[model samples]
Target: MEFKEVVGRRRSIRFFEPDKPVEREKIQVILETARLASCAVNAHWLRAIVVDRDKIPPDKLNQLKTPVAALTLDLAPVHIYFFCDLGVVKRIKGSRLRELVDAGALAPTHGWSHKFVDEFVYPQILEPMTNNLQGYLAAAMADCGGAAQNALLAAFDEGLGACLNTPNPVLTKQVFDVPDDWVSLWVMLVGYPAESWEAGGQRPRPPFEELYYEGDINTPFKRDPGVVEKLKASKMITAPAPLPGRRQEILQLAERLNLPM
Candidate 1:
């Protein structure tokens, strides 16, 4: 599918085919896409543990589910838990940045060199930031979020359904044997959708003008109708949610799945 179409079609698919299984290759593609995402300082803090639904012990799986995501966890065939390693910056100590300099990606024209990293970047910048745990965690998590989004998009591009959910952190760590320095981010539940691909059409969002600004904070960016039309034509902008028969569809699905309406 076209990139725009893939973006358009992405939905937080909560209802998945419980009996179906996702292919290993598709899962690998999602991970590969995430690995290629841009990271600050090339620290590459993101890590993931993919769990097969059927293989997980039932009791442990139950413990891993959060109250809001209980049904989602039970239904998805695969669960990918994301984390950000807080120790990465301290461990690498700007070696990754030096590698970029050596490879010419971080060029001398940009004032990048091995000496620059060791002297100014590491001791002066990175070390101090790492010492302040809260500030350091926020930056690392932001980088992890980018990588997770890439994985999410890849899932849709591979013709699978996925949703980002908060897992039970205490149980997640215990069940997965997570490292002490690894902070939990999110769990992506993956499978084939039980509902229609449109998922009742595109979800709602705040008005574009309210969300963006131009040169001044008071000046809202003027949205061009022509560009909007172009995006709609390319399937990037789709119909709003709660399509016709949506309620009936949900009712039927509830009955079939033995879920309360």
Candidate 2:
């Protein structure tokens, strides 16, 4: 499908064919696409777990409560659970630590080593505990969101469907056995579009100008209305076609994941 058509067709599909199983290799490819997503200092905090319907327990799925998340998690052939590793920040110490130590902060005679450990190392350890969990969460969320979006688009390119759904991190962590420091961010449900309706009754997105601004909230640019309409018609803007080699990379990812597909 063209990017425009894929974007136009992309919808938060809650209903799915319970009997159909998503290809294992396809799921691997999508995750591979997500893995390539960019992150600050190459700290790829996001860890995605692709689970099939049978793997998700009934009571656990019910725990989601919301219709969207429940159906998405329950009915979809595959679910990718996004997680963030807070410990990844420790990798920042390698080159940075050498620079800090060489800069005289670790001078043994002045007891700067003690000061360095106390001032920097201790603070790095305590920061997460003292600071707002929500703040750190938001940053991790933004990091995963890009990767999830990439995954969704990749699915569309592969002639599959996917929807980003909300899931309780508390429940997900327990169900998936993710470490305490590694928190659940969200869930992406993937499958073939099995609904009878075309595009699953999707509505038009809000006008681009109304939502986007130039510099501040007040300052607005005269967006090219025609461009949006054109893209909307083409489905390119909504579902951007994968770049060259993206699909191939996803296929290779299947090998790494060892998924059945």
On TM-score, the leading prediction is: 1
Off by more than 4 A, model 1: none
Location of the lowest summed lDDT over 10 successive residues in candidate 1: 252-261
For each candidate, how many residue pairs have backbone atoms clashing (under 3 Å)? Answer: 0, 10
Best model per lDDT = 1
RMSD of 2: 10.5
Query: Under the 3 Å rule for N, CA and C atoms, how many clashes does model 2 have?
Result: 10
How far off is residue 77 in model 2, in Å? 1.8
lDDT of 1 by residue, 13-125 (tens): 99899989899999999999999999999999999999999899999988888889999898899999998899889899999999999888999999999999999999999
Task: Give the CA lDDT, 0 to 100, for residue 55 in model 1.
Answer: 93
